[model samples]
Target: DQEGRIVFSNPASHRIWDGVGIEELGQYRGWRAETGEPIAPDQWPAVRAVRHGETTLNQLVRIQGSDGSEKTLLNSALPIRRADGEILGAIVLNQDVTEREASDAALRQSQEDLQHSRQLDAVGQLAGGIAHDFNNLLTGVLSYCDLLLQELGPGDPLRSDIEQIRHAGKRAAMLTRQLLAFSRRQILQPKVLSLNSVVEGLEPMLRRLLGTGVSLAVELDPALAPVMADPGQLEQVMVNLVVNARDAMPQGGQVTISTANRELDIAQAGGIPAGAYAVLTVRDTGVGMPPSTRARVFEPFFTTKEPGKGTGLGLSSVYGIVEQSGGRITVESAPGEGATFTIYLRRHAGPEGAQAKKEQRKVLPLGTETILLVEDETAVRNSARRLLERHGYTVLEARHGMDALRLLEESGRNVDLVLTDVVMPEMDGRELVQRLRAERPEHKVIYMSGYTEQAITSGGVLPPRTAFLEKPFTVDQLMRLVREVLDE
Candidate 1:
């Protein structure tokens, strides 16, 4: 006892040191829990109490029994002195807190991840709002550019200038679309689909994009659950991640695309609600990201690449696409350890007919049907009308839904199709459609909007059968969609 040795142990202590030999009890092995360093002999609580006639207060420690079962414990030791003040050995008490500590750590990480997600959402909202307004302005700019370019004769200097203007507008439109995506304001046409099939479809294209320097491997979980998401957008997310990985390793590396089913509780949900999730993991053995870069990797226009090499919307758009599809995304990376991007999408148990891919559709040429165009923005309305009229359609203009209704009722069967903006003052497109269908239930409608993050949710941006036309559409896009909707 005077030699700082454990003479005996109680049943409670025996359970904790179960696999440890009685002879080995004389040398208790432990470490400082916080620092993860072995507890020095001088710093051993029981030894200090027994040899120096001291008392050791609660200390957090990591201990492993002979069986190698490690545990975190709150340990304390006190000198066992008799009534005459002669010290005996000492008594040590340790409270196991391994599970509790792990839970606390998980909670801390979840909170941090949630806070980061909110910050990114705030930035996304601002970007989306700006892009929404810009989309309207660009609609007018691009449409007028299209009209001017068409009027200009070939080999004319003005044609080239107009083409340049058109080119610049197209670029701006692309950037705005990315911003809308990040903001989750862009309209989505979600369908129940399998991630495995999606990965299989894109494998060939992804391989070509990665070049010979990068090896692509896909691991699909046979029991993967279906998720409701836009197949095209999911492809975009995969493409962005693959490109990001490829860029990180300019020389050579391995990229793995995998899918699995994940069940998460709120404590481990990675900023989303607890439930069954369809997980898609993209891992790359490439130059990894530091904490600083990892923090802002999903931020719009934030890039680590040299100037002209990147626009920084790649990951941001990916983040938005997943989030808008009711999913959570997380990234793990260290400077030299490479990076792993994990996306958790809500599992869908829709009908058995859930498609592995969207059906192929036949597109149409320019139209000749009479159409009603209802838009609140005068410039956008005029630009659209001019474009439609030039394509041989009789375009009727309306300032709002009320005006469109008045024009439509007066024109009767003369108006062949109704194309309206979703966000209009004093009777929106949905209400206008309701009024139109009240008289003629068979009438068709197409709703267009710059951003539908706040306004649209139901399928097809309306009920089951309605079509959507996104703003800042190209001349060809407008013509093609109008013809298709009319034919349907």
Candidate 2:
């Protein structure tokens, strides 16, 4: 027994070893748990304990049973000595801790995922704030350019320069829209419509964008249900998905777009409520994403593309649009196995509706109504005043809400409309509107801001029926909106 041989094994040990005796265990095969190398007989904890009078504790090891089954063991061994310190035999203990180790690993991964999600949210908020302020500045620049272009004749040398300035401003405005989308603050006009129809209309454009190297396939279920979503934003989501799929398949592969109606149970729906959904999937047969990249695919400003090739906001915008529309998006991928993006929008039970009609350009209407414009930004305020004055409206400008209120009081509620920013110091547009309505119950108000309606008033400061304007508006937009509000 002192020669590192087991003299007796407990019934528990025998059961764990599949009824094998100590002799069979001595010949059993095993490996180091941390490294898959064979465990030498002399290097075993039990052997070391007896031969060298050493004590080994919590040495993780992998063992193979007589039936060729494997198990992970946390092993410990201690030398058994006589009263005179003479070497006797050794005692060993082993515990199956495989499940506990796996549980710990899962907890760590969840923590890491939560941390990443928080970081992404922080970045998105910062981007949204910057974009809001930038939109205000762009509004001033673009509005002034519009006024300049109107004053200039066709043959004027500076007309082209002003046009270029307008073009740049529009591009910047698009970028700001992307930022707002990623922040989940973009205003959406959701309607109940068939998702299949939206996909059908975009097939031609998608094919052309994917080019000849890639084959496009659309598998739309005719019975797919209608979903409540903004058609334009959904189109953007599809375009972004297709573009990403195309980029993934540089050497040429098939891109498939499919839609179906699904009924999800609580277990299947994840965060969303169990309900019927219109499910859309875009899949590619090209290089896919690794786990690390897939984990951060929807994070803003995170991109794997070369510099200047991507802005890294495509997937983020898609994420925002889906979330804002009360839908959910998920991606599945493995390296070299391609990728698939699945979007689920709640099925609308209401009556199906057609896409909202786009406003048609018509004769620009002029107004003689006295309007009070309150804005914190000087440039934006001046630009609005100039635009209104050129449209034959009496423009009364104030730097903020309180100043506007004072002006309104002095004017004895003679102003026809109060156009004010939703966010301002001293008093916000919401409070100012309350004061104005108290004075003149029939007064009209239009809440305007560079920030998204959701960001400015998540508490419902602006009612659903309130007239609101997004900043960076063209002169035509301003005039038309003002005329519309004044007429109403």
Candidate 3:
């Protein structure tokens, strides 16, 4: 067939190449350059197959059609031989590998996306850990700074310095809080909140932040359900997503945000638990992400933006919030094709299981009650003892939980409140609470810890109504919390 003549062609060849199907099967058997102008018969695979008495394969050479469009062929030819070993024409085969090539490319892209996602997850964990510890330190510093301001006179220079310290500390605390949110380690005060409402409330701010050049649109499903999560943290999630969308569109593009009610069944593929959820999606028409960048988008501190433009923790924080709230997230993007991020958070069934609203009561004086305070830090314990003694209460000091227990056993005095650290060398707050409860069941106890409630106790080990005061407590917070617990 290679003597400038065609041999055999599959029926699908016409369907694939549009027309040049069976008509030219045996008639058009010639080797042509991919240019399709014409090739000498000796240079053709089919011609070589017959002349050299050997098979030949055309891996992926493009062939021109009647319309000048290129068609790729995986062509193979074997010499057709007679019974006495005399060579005849060639039996050629052609397969269209266009769709197969496309599928393979898509599969490669998907694998790359998966790998990037995993890397981001690892980075988020690291960032969250750092934020968690930094938050604890900030909590102590900020609380004490506020307390210091109360002791300084209005005209004192020390008061101004303390105020500046408090302001700076507060800013640092906010950064740490963002980190904690990304890590899912912050003390959460979850509530039943509608995502639609949160978005609506943030619409004005988002529009302003996005500026006049970029357009913003919102699509809200009326049937969208509520999710159980800290309202502040949820708001933070929305803000971060909006900010990310804005950054993506520096050249000016549309940012669209939408929410809907979604249900993930057991067979769903997104690693989401089977449940009803509120789906939040943010899409940007800015510079779309390439396969390489999309993979690490959610990794903490992993950003493709020029330095000083990003911390790379925006998506990571979003990931942490959704995950911690029993939700999942998925991203879709292609190079120059824009991006869309979808977050699925478990829907709250109305407001039935919401944590009780914290009711603020009037601060009262800690009458003549004796308080036993156990702390390891010299400065903190001394400060606490002085603050309590000044508040008209008798104070007993112990360096550790064990020392406190010894004081309780030896001193026959009636101890009204047992304030102890949740983490200590001799005995933690949890063990001390158990011991005190066992010895004197009626005693009041206030536990303090910088970690989350889960981090402080293993499982559900702590008893109900056991008051907690997070550390670096101000004189008023400590006295007020103690008084409230004692009064109860």
Candidate 4:
């Protein structure tokens, strides 16, 4: 009678364990009645509590009971104590939480799946809209820069200023290209490139950009293998990182860039593929990112800086480019401890070195050959006219596609090129191109836009090799693209 067991189990546990009576509980202590099998002693909470002289809870075990059915149980046990602190025995409690656990696991998995899907969808939509608008802006900047360069005299007082304008315009264009690259919407002309060579080439420009107050250091590995990527894009990534670092420092600080050859093993790194990589690390001594900022740093339009200070696309574009290039980027930062952004790119097993040559665009001569300029924006059209005339071309101006066709019909002027805007009020650039091709196949056409190359080229928006110029372009870009189109 001293070993008698009592039955006052919770309703939940009683139904789960199949424990019916007080005597039955003691008799089936080491067994499960549902499955007519014995329980593993080591896994029994009651045994553990009694042997260890302590209580245990939430311990899981698989057991069979009287009906020969298996059930997973989450159990707890406690030693029954007397008023004099003597341990009488143990009280065992079990709950079958198999269904609950399974349901919880399934729900968690579904949520993760849903979140991933939403992120991918969001990225795609954003990439499309961003690329289109970015290309347009680049087009305008490059075109104008080109035009300005043509007007400057070699020893003119404004020559340096004009050159700087050209340089800044080019950088903006490069930024747009990065946006396109990150979106994987830009056409890539990848070549084998040594990391050391790329960094060395940018030393002068980096020095100029960082200014005299900030220190620039490069710790490139001589043994680093070549990587296959667009050199311009890679340079862009470096510049963007450097610029961000510069902005982080109010009083100026050191920006350290290092590149080394390394291999990523699947087991070693969770996300990046196993391969040889050119690990590029950019570190700064400025204020570091907080956890909240770090989490959203790679999201488009997310920035901590004041409005008008940054476009917030720099890091996001960098993230896109790295991801699109079959590489991975990771950031490390601690509040007030500065920050480091590490980029891992798959290395190409090739040549040890050669400095990448600066691409020189061979500017063609402007001729008296006529060009019909069609643009709705008054400022843009005036600039185009001034730019074309300055280049010694007989320029014809029209406000829209219809007006352009009318000028051609009325004047019967020997038109050489139809320079038109892509987006218009009545008939679009693409439509204008079609009408021209049908009516006057003799005259060549060039399309200009702030639209990304992908958007303009897709869905037969613009024909192949039918010269396209991006909006806000400098004079030189306009002339070259125009000449290139005309000569075609």
The residue-by-residue lDDT of candidate 4 on 204-285, one tens digit each, is 9987989977899899898888887767667877888898888888788899999998876642322556778899999998
Which stretches of model 1 miss by more than 4 angstroms? 19-42, 47-56, 64-68, 78-88, 263-267, 272-275, 291-295, 350-364, 409-414, 459-461
What Cα-based lDDT does every candidate model obtain? 0.82, 0.83, 0.70, 0.70
List all candidate RMSDs to the true structure: 3.6, 5.6, 7.4, 11.0
lDDT measured at residue 39 in model 2 versus the true structure, 0 to 100: 85
- Which tens-of-lDDT digit does each residue in 355-380 have in candidate 1? 54334345436677888899999888
TM-score of 2: 0.76
Specify the poorest-scoring 10-residue window by lDDT in model 4: 453-462
Q: Can you give the lDDT of residue 441 in candidate 2?
A: 77
lDDT of 2 by residue, 1-488 (tens): 47656677777666566544334456678888788899876787877777788899999888886678777789898999999987798888878876786677566766775686687678888988998899889999998998899899999999999999999999888888888888787666666888898999899999999999999999999888888888889999999999999999999999999999988775242244578899999999989999899988998888999999998999999988887788888889999999999999988888678665656568788888899999998888888898899889898889887898788678775888888887888988888888877766787878777777433454223454357787778888888878777876
Instruction: Give stretches of model 2 more than 4 Å off.
Output: 1-109, 263-276, 438-443, 453-462, 483-488
**TM-score for each prediction?**
0.87, 0.76, 0.69, 0.57
Better of 2 and 3 by lDDT: 2
Per-residue lDDT of candidate 3, residues 355-440 (tens digit): 34566657645578988888776666766776777678899998888888788779877787888766667787777778778877
TM-score, candidate number 1: 0.87
Q: Rank the candidates by TM-score, best first.
A: 1, 2, 3, 4
